[model samples]
Target: MTIVDTALHDSLRVLKLSGMLHTLDARLVQAQAGELGHLEFLQVLCHDEITRRETMSMQRRLRRARFEQTTTLEEFDFHASPKLPAAQIR
Candidate 1:
């Protein structure tokens, strides 16, 4: 990384943009390879930060919910219990 890149990363860290900082290297590579414009680069960085925050929030909510097991209906075998009311479950 160049001096400018190091300085920018330090500034991002100080500003508590952890999400952007974490993805900085990969995003930089993508920007260079894709020849992304300034606004496009900024958009990607902002999106990464937003996605990180949202994912973290959802994880926190899930932990608070304290589910015994993480399961989805798609993994369920409804046919195994023929008596189960599939329509009511839905």
Candidate 2:
């Protein structure tokens, strides 16, 4: 069944709460099934919004960084730079 009507969806979009909007249908189902209380439902929604914002912020920062390629220190070829200070690099 559809729990979120158009008005509610538009309201959520206007408030920029995409995470809550995305999960609202499933959460509503859970609430109707008696698996969540009012307080718990609100808490979960707030948590989802916070998580979404954090993830978006991180992605924005990474995109701004504009790294040529993705790599990690662990993937470095220590054997090729044996003469270098591998211990210090690690």
Candidate with maximal TM-score? 1
Worst 10 residues of 1 by lDDT: 69-78
State TM-scores per candidate.
0.73, 0.72
Residue 55, model 2: lDDT of 100
* Native RMSD of candidate 1 (Å): 3.7
Model 1 TM-score relative to the real fold:
0.73
Superposition TM-score, candidate 2 onto the true structure: 0.72
Clashing pairs in 1: none
Compared with the true structure, what per-residue lDDT tens digits does model 1 show for residues 1-90? 899999999999999888899998988988889877779899999998999899999999999999998867777778999899877897
Tens-place lDDT digits, model 2, residues 4-79: 5777888899999999999988988899899999999999989999999999998898899998876678887888
